[model samples]
Target: MTRDQVLEFVKAHPASFMATVDGGEPRVRAMHTALIEPVGLTFCTGVNKDVHRQLVANPSVELAYWDPKTGVQVRVRGEMEHLDDLDLKKRIVNDVFTFLQPVVEQFGYDVLSLFRLAKGTSIVWRAAQGAAPMEVAEF
Candidate 1:
C-alpha cells in the first residue's frame, strides 16, 4: 500500500491498541486517536494511568489496528512525546468530542493529557488481497 493509503486507513479507523514496555514486560491498552494529521498520530490519556507512567519511563511505543471485514491490519511503532501546548490540547479535545458527541453530552473541555508519537519509526500494513505486506519507515 502507498503512504496515502496507510494514512487514509488510519484516519478511517479511530481506535487502536497501544503497547508500551515496562521493565522487561509489555503492556497493551485500547486507546483512541485524538488526531491523525500529516505530522503524526496524537492521543490522550489520564496522567495517572499506568500507560502514562510507562511512556514517561520509555517513550517507545507501538500502535496496532485491524479491520475484520477487509482482513487488513496495521502496526505503527515510534517514539512518543507528551505535548504541553494548550492550543494543541484544545484542538484535540474538540476533534475527539466532535466524533464522540453521539454517545455523550457536551460539557466544557477538561485538561486531558495529550501525546504525539514521532513519525520517524515505522508503519507496517498487511492485507489478504495485497501482493505483500507494506512496511513504511517514516524518516
Candidate 2:
C-alpha cells in the first residue's frame, strides 16, 4: 500500500491499540486517535499516566488498527514526538477528546500530553492474504 493509502486506512479505523515499552516489558492499551494529518497520527494521554512516562523515557511505539468486517489490519511503528503546542492541546480537548475536559479542569491542559508519530513504517495485512507478505509503506 502507498503511504497515503495507509494513512487513510488508519483514519478510517481510528480506534486502535498502542504498544509502548515499560522498563523491559511491553505494554499495550486501547487508544483513540486524537488527530490525523499529512504530518502524522496524534494521540493524547494524561501526563501523570504510566503511558506518558513510558513514552517520555522511550519514544518508540507501535500502533495497530483493524477492521473486523474487512479483516484488514494496519500497523505503524515509529518513535513518538511529544508535542507541547498549547493550541493543539486545546483543539484536542475541545474537539477530539471532550471527555478530558474534566481532567483539564482539574489539572489544566498540561495534564493532557500529546504525542505524534511523525515518521513511521506502516504495514497492511489482509486476512485473505493469509501468510503472504504484507504491503509496507513509509510515511
Candidate 2 runs further than 4 Å off: none
The candidate that achieves the highest TM-score relative to the unseen native structure = 2
* Cα lDDT for residue 93, candidate 1: 51
For each of the candidates, give the backbone clash count.
0, 0
Candidate 1 per-residue lDDT over residues 12-68, each given as its tens digit: 886899999999799999998888877778887766678888988898988988887
The global C-alpha lDDT for each of the candidates, from Candidate 1 onward, is 0.74, 0.91
Q: lDDT tens string, model 2, 1-139?
A: 7777877888899998999999899999999999988889999988889999999999999999999999999999999999999999999989988988888898888778899998888988999999999988787
Top lDDT model: 2
Residue 103 displacement in candidate 1 (angstroms): 16
